[model samples]
Target: MPQHRALLIGASNYDMRGIHSLPFIPGDLARLGSALRRRGFKDVQVLSQLEGGKQLGANFIKGCVAGFLRRAGRGDTLVIVLSGHGVHAAGRDYLVPEDIHEDTHPFESGCVPIDWGRDLDETPADHVVFLIDACREGIEVASMSVAGVTQWGRQKTDAALRRKVAYVYGCSPAQLSLYVRDHEAVTDGVQCGTVPGESFSIFSRAISDVVTSHQGALALDVFREAVQERVSLLHQAYRKRGNPQLLRTITDIPHNAFTFLPAAAGRHEAATPPVTEYPATPSRSTSPWWSTPASPPSGLRPQPALTRTAEEDRLIPPAPSHSAAPGRGQAAGPVGLPPRLRGSSPGPRHLISRRRVLLGLAGTVLTGVGFTAWKVIDASTPDRQLWKFNTREFVQSSPAVAGGVVYVGSGDGKLYAVDAATGEEHWSFATGEWDASSPSDSAVKSSPAVADGVVYVGSQNKKLYAVDAATGKKRWSFATGGEVYSSPAVAGGVVYVGSRDEKLYAVDAATGDERWSFATGDRVDSSPTVTKGVVYVGSSNDKLYAVDAATGDERWSFATDFHVESSPTVADGVVYIGSYDAHLYAVKT
Candidate 1:
C-alpha cells in the first residue's frame, strides 16, 4: 500500500528586524495540518517557532527535511511545505529560519537552500510536492540587495519510477504573498476570536477553501488552478474594497490528474476514515463522474452563441458602450454566476474585444480601424473611406505600422502584413492552425511591436514570436508557461512582455534568450515601457511597478483602486497610466 507523508514548516518570527513577523503563520500551520490529516495524511509533522516553541535553524531544517524524505519509500508520496521569508541571493533560493539574522550570508549560515530535487531525485517516493508560501524578495532586509526565487520548471531528466513532481508557489517568483487581515471573509466556520489577529496568507486561505469545499478526491492540477483563479478574483475584490494587497500562484505541475487529497464530510472535514492506501490515478474505464462535463443547472439556458461570419467563425463581441449593471430580476452580481461566488463583472478592459484594434498607416496617410470589419479611412478626411480588408475572424489585436506596412492579428490565429498604400496583403503568418471546437484557440490578441526590422507579437499559444518584418517569417519564439496576452515592448536590445503566468519577462531581443523576469501579484497583461533605465508596467494586482531595466529589481510600486492593464506612457519624467477604477494617474518617474 502507498503511504502519504507531509512536513510543514512555518517560520513566523524572524531574528532580523527587517523581516516582518507573520502573526498568522501559526494559524495557517494548524489549518493545513488538520486539512491534510482529514485527506488521509495521518503522519503530518509541523515545525514552527510560534507553535512548536523551538528555534528553527538552517541545520535543524535540513535534518528534518532529510529525515522526512528518508522515511518515504517506493509507492509513497511526500509533501513538503515551507511558509516563511524566502530569499534569492547569489543566484540561489533560500528559506529563512527563525534564527536567521542580517549579519551573515546565506552561504555560511541562517538559511537553507531550496535545491529540493537534488535529494528528491534519490528518494524512493513515486511523487513529491512542494507548497511554498513566502515572499520571493529578500531585498527588504537592508543587508541583502538581490531577491527572488528561480521560476519552477521540471527538466526532462528524472528518475524513471518517480511518476510526478509538483511545485505550487504562493506567488510568482518575485511577487509577494500577502497575509490577509480579514481572513473570515474568505473562509467558512471561523470563530471570531479564535487566535486573536487570526489571519492567513491569501494562498493558504485559497488552498483551504478548495480542499474543504469538495466532497471527493481533489486532483493536484485542479487544486492549483482553482486556487490561482480564486486568489486572482479575490485580489480584484480586495482592490475594489480599498485594500492594496493581492496575490496569485505560480506552478510547474501539469494536468496528469493526480489526486492529492481524499475528501471527507463538511467544510472542516472533522470526521475522516483511516488511510489504507494512497489514491491512485483512476483508469478511463473507472473514471470519476466529475471527469466528464456536467450539464448546466436546471432552468439555466446554454450561453447564446455569438453571431458568426460567413466562414462559421465566431465574431468577437462588440465593446460595451458603458459599464454593465445587473439586469432586472438579477441579484447585484455577475449575471451568470451563483450568488456565493458572484461580484461585479469587470469592464471591457477585463474581456478581450475586437473593436480595440486600430493603427495609423503613414505610407497611405490612412487610419485603419478593425471594428468588426477592417477598414482604412483617409487621415485628412475621417469620413472618406480608402480601402477595406476582410479577415476570416474578428481582428482582435491592434495593428502595428512599420516601413510602409501594416501588421495586425486576428482571432483566426493569423498575423497579416499588408501594403500600407493599397491595403493589399504582403504576407500572412499563421500563429497556429485553427481548431473547430475552440475557434479562439491560439488567438493572436496581443498587439504587434515592431523594432529593428523584427515584429514581436504574442499569441494564445503561450509564445512570444519575433517575426522578420520584411519577409513575415518566424525568426524566434519564446515559450512561456501561460498564454501571452500582453503585447511586446522592445528597447535597449531587450524585448519586454507580460504573460498570464503572472510574470513580466525580459528577453534578449536578438537571441531570444531570457534576461530576467519580474513576477507580479497577478497576471501581467500590461505592456511595459522602458525609459531612462527603468521599466514601468502595470499588473492585474492593481498596481503600477517601476523596475530596474537591467536587474529586474523593483524600485517602487504605486497602487490603484483597480487592475491596471493600460500600457504606461512616459513624458517629461512622468508616467501616465489608467485603471479599471475609472481613474487616470500621472506619477513622477
Candidate 2:
C-alpha cells in the first residue's frame, strides 16, 4: 500500500461562550495522529492552540499548505482533520480556530468554510479528506453579533489545482454537537483531579473507533454502521442526562476513492438466496388440487349402461328424461321410456341409476364452485403476523422493511427494529437526543431508509445518522448544513437529502463521502425525490428544482406559492408535491 499524508488540527478555545470546552483536545489529536501514522500515513502533522500563539490561524494554514506541497502527489492521499467550533455567516461554513476573535469574519478568520472549493484546486493529491468537528452557524443555534465585525478574508494562493476531495462534517447546520462527562475513562479506572464539565463528543469517539477497529474497512457504508452503533448506545446511556445530538455531512469528488479496498474486491457480499421461508405457515394452503384426493359416499350405486341400436348409437341421440317411477312403481329405461315389463313399467334399479347420475353431476358442479371460491379467498388473504414490539416514544416515520425486519426511528431518539409481520422489537439503538423539530410531538418523526443493510434517518436535533440494520451498531455520520428533517434517498451508491440549512447534499452511500451540493434560497424541508438521473426537491422559498443527480446542476426550477415543505413524490413521469400554500402541484417531467 502507498503511504498517505495528513494534516490534523484541533481547536480547544473559542471567542464564543459555551463553545471552548474541549478537555481532551491534545489527547484526541495525538491519538488520532498516532493511529493514522500506524495505518501507513508516512507524513502526519498535528497542530493545536496548546502550541501557544495568537497567530495560530496563520501558522495552521501555512503548515497545511506546506504539508500538501511536501508529501501530496498525483496519486497520494491528503487528509485534513479539524476539530473546533464552527460558525456560519452570510451563507458560508467556517471552522473557528481557538485564536479567532468575535470580530473575525469567516473570510477574514482562519476558519475553513463549507465551500472550500478553492482549496481543492490548490492541493495536488489523488484524494483529499477534509474533516471538521464544529458547530455550523445559521443552522440550529441562533446567530450572534460581535461588535466591530471584520471584513471577509481571502486565500493566499489562487492557483487552480484539480484534485479529488472528500469533505465530512460533524453535525448538521441546524443541530448542536454533544459533549458528555468522561464516563468511559471513569469506568476504565482512569482518574484525574476534580474536573468540571469533562465530557467526550459522541461523533468524535465514533469516528476514532471506526478508524481503529475496522482497519481497511474504511468505506462510508462500513464507517456509518460503526458510528451509528456507538451513537445509539451513548444515546441510551444518557437519555436522562440530556446528551447532545450527532449529525453528519459529506461531499465527495468524482471518481474519488476514500477507502483502501480495491474495486474488484468490494465490501458488499454477492447475492445468493432468492427467497426466505415464512416463520409460520402461510395464511393459505400451498397445495394444488391434484395433490389431495376427494372423498365420496361409498353407498352410491353405479349407473347402468344405455342400450341402443347400432345406428342410433352412432347418431348419438340425446338422453331421454323421465319422471321418477310412481312410488317405486316402475324403472325407466335409458331411452326415457318405462322398462318393458313385457309391456309393463321399468324396474326400481333403472330409476335408482338415473338418480345416481343426476347426483354425481350436481356434486361435480358444486366441487368446481368450491375450488374456485377457495382460490379467490387465498389470493385475498393477508400474510400471517409474525412479531410486534413497542418503543418508549412514539413512532411517526414509516419503517424501512428489509431482511424480514422493520427499521424505524422514534421521537425518543432511538432507532428500532421490530418484526415486520409481528411488530416485535428485535432491538433498539438510541440516538441520544430528542426530535423537537417535527410538526407533531412524536418520538421520531423521520422515517428510516435502509439500503445495503444500513439504516439512515434524521432527527429533530438537526442530524442525520446511519446504523447497522442487523445489530444496531453505529457507523459513520456526516454533518449537514441544517436540521435533517428529510429522510435520505439512496441510489447509485449515493445518499441524497435536504436540510433546513437550505442545501441538498449528495454523499457516497458506502463511505460518507460528499459528492456534490446545491443551495436553495430558503430551508429545504422536502426530502429529495430522485429518478432517471434527476433530483426533485421543494424549498421553503416556494420553488421546485430539477437538478442533475450526478452533477448537482440545475436542470430547471418552477416557482410556487408559499413554502413547499412536503416531500416530492415522483412516479409515472410526474412529480407530485405539496405546498404550505394549501395546494398540491403536479409537475410533468
Candidate 3:
C-alpha cells in the first residue's frame, strides 16, 4: 500500500497582542493529526503555536507543499487540515497563519495570497483533501452561514501546480465563528466566566467529527451536511440567546470537485446536474358573478312617455307649473322612506331601536352560553398528543425519550426537558458555555446522552458531567485532559466518553470514578457505540477500532483514507462509518 502524508496547521496564538488563552486551533490540529495517523498516514505533521514559529506564513505553505511532494504519487492521496483565523478581502479568502498579526493586512505582513494548487506542482496525488476552519468575512450570513465556504479556488495561471483538490470550509463568507464558555463552570472567574471570542469554529469541529466518525466515508456531500448541521446548531444557539449577529464563513478550493458523492470516483465528474422545474398553476377570476347582474324588483311604477312631432315640438309648447301636482317632491320612493308623525305605526326609528334591543339581549345570552360550552369541552379534551419541538438548532445528539419527556442538549449550553407530546419545555439546565469547549473564541458543539435517570454529557469545559436527568441538576463532574466533544455512551454499568485529551475514558456508572482510559494519538471525539461484546468508535487518529467492551482491548481495527470523526453506527453485523478521505466504509466482524 502507498504511504499517505498530511500537514495539519492549527494556529492558536496570533502575533497581535491578546490573551494567550485556550483556543481550539491547536486542539483541532492535534485531532486532525491523530486521525490521519490512525488512517495509516505514515507521516502526519502538526504545526501549532506551541511549536513556536514566527514565520508561519512561509512555514505552512512550505510544509504542505513538501508533504504533498514527498508522499504524493499516482494512486496516493494528500490531506491538509488548517484550523485558524481566516478572512476574505477583495473577494478572495486567506487563511491566517500562527504568526499573523490581526492589526496588519494579509498583503502587508500576514500570509500572502496562495492559490489552492500552489503546492500541487510536481505531485501526482490521486486526491487532495483540504479542510479549512475559518471565518469568511463579506456575504449574507442567514442562508449561506449554515454551510461553510463550498466554492473552491479557481484554476489560475499555475498550470503545473493545478490538480484535483477537494476543499471544505467551516462557514460561509458572511457568518462568524463563535466561542463561548465551557459547560461545567458556575463561578464567574476567568476559567468560569464568559470567554470573549468565537469559540467553536463550526466548520472545523464538524469536519473533525464527521471525518473521525465516518472513517473513510468522508465524501464531499457528507462533509457539507455535517458542516451545515453544525452551523445551523450554532446559529440557533446564538439566536436563542438573542445574539443572531454572530456568524462565520466557509469556502472551498477546486470548487467544481467539492460535491456529495457515494464514493471517491463520484467526485471526479465535472458537470453540475440540471435542476428540475415544476409547472405553473392556472389562473382564476376573482368576481363571484362575472356573467350577469341581479334584476330589479317587480311592482314599481313606470315613467310616462312624451308625445310630440319633431317639427311641432321644436316650434311651440309650454306648461303651467302650478297645475302639475301637489307635494310631488315628497312622495314615497324606493330611495327614501315616507314622512311620518311621532306616533305613526311602525316608524323606521322605532323599529330600529326595538331590533337593536333584541339583538343586544340575544348576543349577550349566546356569548355566555358559548363560552360555558367551550370551557367544558376544553376541560374534557386530553393533552396527551405527541409534541414536535422545532428547534432552529441541530439536535446532533440522540435524545433520551422517556417518562413522557424528551431530554436533549443544545449547542446553546442548555439541557432541556420538553413534554414529548406537546413540545413544551418542562425544565432546562444551563451550562454557561458552548458544548465544545474550544477556547473563549469558539462555540460549544457537544451533545448530551442520558441513561439510568442520569444525563451524561461532555462540555467544552474539558470535563464530563453526570447530572440528574429529571431535575437537570449536576451530580458529579470529572475533569479530563482536553475538551470533551464526544457524547457519553453507557453500557455494562459503565460510561464511555472520548475527550480532546486524546483518551477514551471508561467511568463508573454509579460514581464518577475513572475505571480506565485508552489513550489515542489524537483527540477522540468519536462517541463509543457498544454492541454485543465490543465497543466500536472512530478517532481523530483515523482508525476505526473494535475494542473489547469490558477491557478496552483492541479487537479489530480498520484504517481509512483520512480522518474519522464520524461516530460508528452498528447494524446487523456490519459497522458503517464515514471519513474525511471522502469515502464511507462498511466493515464486518
Candidate 4:
C-alpha cells in the first residue's frame, strides 16, 4: 500500500535573541494539521508549542524533518507545511528555527536553509508538496520599508523528492507576509479561512479552505492559479502588498491530477483492499492519459464530434478578476469557492485549459469506479516493475547490466550479481560488514562498470576492486586516499573513477596500476563520462571539468554552483548532469 505522510511545523515565539517572536504561529500549526488530517494524510506530525509554544533549538526541527523524510518510502506521498518567521541573508533564504544564532561562528543560523536536500542523496516519496506560509524577506509592515537582505527561500523539491513536487509560497520573493488582526465587518467577498476575529494569517487560512473544499483534488496548475487568485484577491482587497508565487521549473510536465482530498474522501479509498501482486504487463491498454479526442468543457455531456475547430481551440478564457474595495483598509478575508466552479476559469500555463479538461471528464470513462486520472489529456507512458531484490540497506549505486547478470552495490557493503530475467540471486561479494557489526558509514555503495570480462567498482573501504563479472570474485584491488564513491567508467585501456579524496584517477583496466591522476578543488563524486578523448566530471567545488582522457591534462572547465553528485551522461555532443542548485545542465562539446 502507498503511504501518505505530513510534516507540519509552526515555530512561533522564537528565542528573541536570534529570531523574532510570533505569537499566532500555534494557531497555524493546529489549523494546518487539521486540514491535512481532513485531506486523508494518514501519518501527520505536528511540532509546535513544544515546552509551551517555544522550541529550544534548530537541531530539534532538523531532527524531526529528517525523521519524517526517513519514514516515507518511494511510493509514498509527503506534504510539508511551514508557518513562522523567515529570514534571507546574503543570497540564501533560511527558515528561522527557535535558537538561530546569526552571530555565532559559521553563523549557525539556527535555520533550515533551502538547501535542505544537501544531506539527502535521494528520497523515497514519489509525490512531495511544500506549502510555505512565511515571507521571503522581513519587512516592517507598520511602515513601508523592507528590512531583509536577500531573496526568499526556495526549494528544489522536485530534484530532492526525485518525483513530482508542487510548491506554494505565502508571498512574493521581495514581499513580507502580513498577519492582520480581525476586525468584525461585512465580508460578502471574504473567503472561509479567516473569520471576523480570527488570528490566522490570510495565506494559511486560504490554503486550508481550498484543500478541504469540493475542488480538493484540483490539478496542480489549476490549484496553483486558484490559490494565487484567492490569496492575491484577499491581499489586494485588504490593501496588503504581498503576492503569492508558485515555482515549478521542471520541464515535460505531465497532466496528472493532484488532489489533497479530505479524510472523508479517503475513507472510501481506505476500504479498498491492498494490491499485493501485479502482473508485469497488463493485457489491456490502461493509461491515465486520453486515447479519445478531447472534448470542450461546454457542459457535462459527450461531444458530437471528436475534433474541435482551430477557432474553438483558441477560445481560451481569461482569468476572472475580482474588484477590490475602493478604500483599501483591510477589506476582506479569503475568497470562498462554490461546490461547483463558477465565474470565469483560466487554463493551465501549458495546456489549453485545466477547467476545460476537468469539466469534460464528467461524462467520459475517466471518472472511473475508483481511480481518477489527474492528467487525462496527455497520453501516459506505460509503467511497470520489472523485478525486485532487497539489499538490506539503501541501494545508492546504479546497477550495471551485462551478459544477463545485473551487478549492484548496496549500503550493506556487498556487491550482488542477480539473474536479469528472474531477479534471483546468482552470487554476492562482501567488502565489509556494513549490514552486520561494521560502522553505519561503511558500505559498498559504488556502481559497477563492466568492460571486457571484469567488473570495476569502488568501495567505502577506500579501495577499487576488479571483480570477475561471471563469478563475482575479486581479481585485483587498488587503494585510494578516500572512499571510492564514484562509479568506474572504462574507455580504451583505462578505468576512470573519482574519489572523495579530491582526485580523479585513471588506472590500467587489467593490472590495477595507477596510470594518471588529476586534482580538483574538492571531493569528486561525479562519475566520469568519456566522449571523444575528453573526460567530463563534476566536483564539490562547483565546477565541471573537461580533461584530456589520455594525458590527464587540463582542457577546459565550466563552473556552476555544482554541488554535483550526479554522473555526467554523454549523448550526441552534449554532457548532461544535475547539481544541488536544482539545475540539470547540458553542455555542448
Candidate 5:
C-alpha cells in the first residue's frame, strides 16, 4: 500500500525579542498529530519546542525538512505543519528560525523563505501541503508592540506548480491573530485557547476540529470552504476581522490531492461523522471523494509501530551566516534602530506656551512649569548625537565588550554583536530561535555576560542561555517557570539565575541542565552575586535570600516592608542590598 509522510513543527516558545510565546501549540500538535496517526499516517514525525525543547519551522528546511523531502519519491505524500511566528521582508515572506535576529539580517538570514524550489523538476514529490498557523499578516494589538509581522511580496506565487504546492495561512499579514475568550456571538464550531474557554486562537482550533470531524476522504477544496465559512461566521458574530481562505492552493481539478490516492489504505477510507458536535456540511468540490466501508474491515484498527520501508534523509546543513558585520574595510551606514511598532505611544507632547517651551528647552525651571511636555536634553547639550546607533527602540540594556566587539540586547528582539569602533553588526542571535526564550514579555532584558568563549544571558521569555561568544551559535539554554530578568553568574561550571516564577535555578553551564532550584515567595529579577559557597539575590516578595550554591537550599532570608529588585553585593563578611522601601541594609554573612 502507498503511504504518507508528515513533518510537524510546533514552536510554542519563541526567542525573537519582541514577539511572544504560544504555549497553546503543544495542545495543537497532540490534538492534530494524534488524529492524523489514527487516520493512518505512520510516518508522522514531530518537532515541538514545548515537548522536547527543539527549534521549529525557520531553520528546519536545511536540517530535517529537506532530508524528509529527498527520501520521498514520485508518489509519496508530504504534509508540513508550522505553528509559530512569521515575518515578511524584501518582497518575500519568511518563517522565523528559533534564533532569528531581524536587526542583524531582516531579509535573508535568521529566516526561512517560502517558495517552490528553484527547480520544480528537482523536487521529491508533487503533492505537498503547508498548513501554517502563523500570521502572514502583520499583528496589531492595542496594548502590545509586535516587531516583525510585516509582509513584502515581489512576485506572485508560482502558477506552474499550483497543483503541487499549497499554503494555508492562519491570518493575512495585515493583522494579528488574537487568542480570545468565547464571544458567545462567535460561532460555536470550535474555539481554541490555552485556558480552555479563554485565550483561544480561533484559526488553529478550527483546522484541528475540521481534521478530526470530517466524515470521509478530506478534500482540500472542501476544507477550504469550511474554513472560510467558519472564520467568516466568526467575524460576523463578534465585530471582528479576518478571512481564512484556501487562497493559493487547489486546482481546477477540484479536490486536488485529497482525492489523489483512493486505493491507498488508511489514507482517506471514509468520511465518518467527525468528532465534533457541529453539523458537517457536504463538500463544495466537484471532484470525487472517498468513504470507508460501513464497518471498515474487522481487522483494521490503529496499528502498532511498523518497520519503515522508505529511506529517511536528513536536512542539509546551513552555511555560515553571511550577514555577519562586514569587515572594517567595508563602507556601511551606522547601525539603525528597528522601526517603531505601530500604534505606540505618541512621541513628545508639545508645550502650550512658547516661553515655557523655550525655558524647558533651555533647561531653566519655571515656578510651576505648567507645561505638559518637556524634552530630556537641555539647550546646553549638543543637538546631534555623535554617530548614534539607532536601534529604533528603547536601549535599556547595558553593553558588554570583548575582542573589539560590543554585545547588547534590544527591545527589537536581537542580541547584536557589533564592531565597537564602527557600530557595524558582526552577528546577532534571535532569542526564540534557540532555547533562549520567547520575545513576548519585553523578552530580552538581561545584559550579556561573556566568558570563556561563551555569552550568557536571561530573557523575559523565562530562559537562561549560553551561546558561542564568536559565532552566536547556541551552546545551551535552561527554562524557568516564570520570566527571567535575573542575570546569570557563572562559577564552578554552573549557571545561577532567577525568574519571576519565584525560583532561583542552578544549572550546568556546559549542558544547560538544571542541577537544582530554590523557590521564593514571589518573582526574582535580582542578579546573583556568587562568591565562596553562597549565592546572594533578592526577590519581589520583599526579601533577600542567601542560598547554598551546590544544594539550592536557603541559608537565611532578610525581610523588608517593600519588594527588593536590587542585587546583592558582598565584601568581607558583610552583605548589602537596597530595597524598594527606601532603605539599604548591610547584613552579616
Candidate 6:
C-alpha cells in the first residue's frame, strides 16, 4: 500500500534584522496539516519555533529535510511544505532559516538550497509535491541583489525535475501571499488569529479549502481552478489596488497523485456537494475542521532523528549577537530634584515665563540627580514643594505621564515608575549594566514610550527593552549593533528606534522582533517620531529622514550643515527639526 507523508516547516518569528516576523505562519501550518490529513496524508510532521526555545537554523532544517526524504521510499507520496522567508540567489532557490542574518551568505550555509540533486530528486518517493508561500520581492544584500522569494522558472523547473513531481509556489515571483488580517474583514471560510483559528497565508488557505471541502476524487485541473478562483477573490478583498498574486506551478504529476480515492474506486468516486463559501470554504459537516483521525497502521514507520555532521556544525554556527550585560543590584531610595529648581531661592523677584520655568525644571532634572516635584510661584500663593523621588544616578530621560503614573529612565541603567500625585516610587526595572566606570555606556538616555500597558525604552548598552508599565517586569529585549540613545516611538503595534550602527529599526511591539531596518550614513542618536504612516528621524550624518513606517524604506531626507540631534516634530504636514548648524528646519511633508 502507498503511504502519504508530509513534512511542514513554518517559521513565524524571525530573530534576524532584515526579515520581518510572520504572525500567520503558525495558522498556515495548522490549516495545511488538517487539509492534508483529510486528503489521506497520514504521517504529518511539523517543525516550528512554536515548539518554544528551539531555533529553526539552517543546519537543523536541512537535517529535518534529509531525514524526512530518507523515509520516503518508492511507492510513497511525499508533500513538503515550506512557509517562511525564501530567496533566489546565484540562479538557485534557497529557503531562509529563522536565524539567518542579512550579512550571512545565502548560497553557502545560512539557507537550505532547493535543488534537484539532494532536496527532491534524490528522494525515492513515487510522487512528490513541493509548496512554498513567501514574498517574491527583490532583496538587496551588501552590493548584490537577490530575489526575496523562490523564482522557479518554467524552463528551470522542467529541467530540474525528471520524476512525477509538482512544484507550486503561492504567488508569482513578484507578489507576497498576504495574511488574513491584512484585509479589512476576515473571509468567512479562512481560519485566522493565534488560537485554533490559525492565521494562514492567503495561498495556503485556498488550497486547504479546496482539499477539505471536496469529498471525492479531486482532479488536478479542478483543484487548480478552485484554488485560483479563491486566490482571485482574496486579492479583491485585500483592497490594495487589486494586487493579485496568482498561483504559479510547474508540474507533470498525474491527477491521481493528489486524489484520496482508493485503488478500487472508479475514475470519479463522487461529486462533492456544492460549497457556497467563497475564498476557501470549509466543509459542510458540523465537526471541527481541525479534528484529527485515529493513528495509522502499525507498519507506518517514524522518521529518523535529525543529525548533523561535524562539517555542517562548523559551517553554520548559531547566530551571533552582542547582548547587553545583566543588571548589578536592586536599590530603593528617594528620588530628588536639584535645589536650583526651587522658585523660592530669590534675592530679587524676577518675572519668569512659563516656558522658561519648564525649561529650567527640565535642565535641573537632567543634572545627574533624582526627579523633583517643585511648586512654581504664583500671585495667589508663595512658592512651595510637593515631594521628591531619587535614583542612584542621573535622570536624563524625560518621564512619560500615563494613568497617573510617571515612567522615566536613569543613567544608572534603570527605569523607574512613580506615582504622579504622591511622588512615591512604584517600581524600578534595570535594563542592563555595561561599564559603570563609563556613564555613557551605562546610561539609558532614551525617553520611554508607554503604550498598551508596555513601556518601551532604549539603553546606551546597545539594546531596546519592552517592560511592563505597572509591574516593571521585563517583557523582551532586542539587541542592536551599537549604543541606542534614540527614544522609541510606538504606533500600530510597532516600535521604531535608532542606534549608533547608522540604522533605524522597526520592531514588533509585542514580540520585540525586528520588522525592518533603514540604514544611514552615520550613527543615529536622534529619536524617531511616527505619524500618518511616516517616521521622521534625525541622524548624526547631518540629515533628517522620513521613512515609511511599515516597510522601513526611505521616503525623503533633508540635509543640514551639521548633525541633527533634535527629534522631529510633525504638524500641519510639515516636519520641524533642529540641527547643530544653528538652524531649525521646517520641511513640508
TM-score of each: 0.45, 0.42, 0.39, 0.49, 0.40, 0.42
For model 1 the TM-score comes to: 0.45
Model 6 steric clash pairs: 27-198, 27-199, 334-390, 335-389, 335-390, 336-389, 336-390
As for TM-score, the candidate ahead, 1 or 2, is: 1
Model 1: worst 10 consecutive residues (lDDT sum): 328-337
In candidate 5, what are the lDDT values of residues 1-589, reduced to their tens digit? 4466777776556665555666656555655665566556768777765335655545565456666766766766677777666665555666655655446533355667666465333566656777776663223322222235433221235534544666666654344544444222323322221111223345665554445433245456556655544454334333355432222232212242244212223533453312222222212231112111222222223212211111211111122333322321111111110111101123221223223234422332211111111243443443422223554334445666778776777655567777655556778787654322222344466877888888888876677889898899989878888767678889998888888788999989889998999999777878998989999999877799999999998899998755688889999999999875546899998
Tens-digit lDDT track for model 4 on 442-496?
5666889999988899987788999998888888888888888899899998999
Q: Residues 371-437, candidate 1, lDDT per residue (tens digit)?
A: 2222343333334335567676656588778887888887778888887667788998988998743
- Judging by TM-score against the true structure, name the best candidate: 4
Q: Top model by lDDT, which number?
A: 6
- lDDT of candidate 6 vs native? 0.64
Off by over 4 Å in 1: 50-52, 106-109, 136-139, 148-163, 182-197, 236-253, 265-589
lDDT of 3 by residue, 327-412 (tens): 11111111101111111122121111112233222122111100110111232344312224543233444555667666666545
Native RMSD of candidate 3 (Å): 30.5
Give the clashing pairs for model 1. none
- The lDDT values for all models are 0.63, 0.53, 0.50, 0.59, 0.56, 0.64
Candidate 2: tens digits of C-alpha lDDT, residues 7-61: 7777765554534446555455665665565455777787765434443464565
- lDDT value, candidate 3, whole model: 0.50
Off by over 4 Å in 5: 50-54, 116-120, 136-155, 173-175, 181-200, 234-589
For 48-147, candidate 6 gives per-residue lDDT tens digits of 6545666688778778878888778677877788877777676567777777766765333577776545656677776677777755332333332564
By TM-score rank, best first, the candidates go: 4, 1, 2, 6, 5, 3
